[model samples]
Target: MTLLLSVALFGIHSLMFYLLKINTDSYSYSLLELYGFFTPIAVFIIIVLIFVHRKNKDAVGYAFMALTCIQMAANYFMLHPMLQQNLRPQKINFFILFALFLAMETIITARILNNKQ
Candidate 1:
């Protein structure tokens, strides 16, 4: 499901970028590259969350919160190159991409966390 959604998002993002004519600036990763980079992380994070929930129900919430922060930090790492280059366009694009995945991840994990076994 995560992979499917990520592919869907990648499609939409690609369409939007094409429509808007957004170009990848110097030292900035392209949108396709960004999606590829984050997709596996998102997929793995969900897997970890599932395992955490199954292994210790009580710890799932804490794990979710901690992992979410880690995601934010990961986003920062992904954007650092653009930050160093002072590219507003790429930074802004990254922000949008991050927010989309963040929301998707939060919703997916939140559902898993809230499920009472």
Candidate 2:
């Protein structure tokens, strides 16, 4: 699930950049910044989730949902200004993409949490 989500996001991101004709250098730098800042925190959360899952699957699922929410919030806060300044023309597209991503994430998380397994 995670791998699928990652690949989908990457493809969408790349397509957005291509279709919008965004400044690749600046956009790439921003993405690098986001990755560098969030990767460690995301890894730590996943590690903890793994441990928690062994004890309580539901708890881990909720944690994953919360983690996804936090990540979306952080992305919005961190990227909004950059999008406004650099990708002004494509800002709406970015927001739409982000909203779609969040909706998909929420659905996926809910499904995992509600699973009887």
Candidate 3:
């Protein structure tokens, strides 16, 4: 789940670079900044998942649910700054994507937890 979120973020970052015509250096920096920002949280989740899986394999799905929450939080934080910026069409598209990702994450987390039980 964590990897999935990372991949999604990377993909979005790439798409943004292409569509926004942002400078290559700026695009690379933005990607690294966002990726670096999320790294510690993802590592913590992985550590917890490792420990939980070691104690009980059945709890792995719960780890994924936890990851969903973390990813959603990351997404929300990523956009928090954008919300203050002047509105633009691309930013609006990003907002839609953000909301859609959150909704999908909510559904995925619920399903994962339900199956875990």
TM-score of each: 0.89, 0.51, 0.47
lDDT of each: 0.82, 0.60, 0.60
Q: Which tens-of-lDDT digit does each residue in 35-73 have in candidate 3?
A: 565555555656665666667768767776877677777
Best by lDDT: 1
Evaluate residue 48 in candidate 2 and report its C-alpha lDDT on the 0 to 100 scale. 62
Q: Which candidate wins on TM-score?
A: 1
**Model 1 C-alpha lDDT versus the unseen true structure:** 0.82
Candidate 1 lDDT by residue in tens digits, 1-117: 989998998899789878987665563687678989888888888899899988998887788789888888888887777778867777777888788877888898889977988
Off by over 4 Å in 2: 12-54, 57-65, 83-86
Error of 1 at 48 (Å): 0.5
lDDT, candidate 2, 38-100, per-residue tens:
445455555666666667986877788688778778777866676657665445544555575
Model 2 per-residue lDDT at 44: 55
RMSD of 3: 5.9
Greater-lDDT candidate between 1 and 2? 1
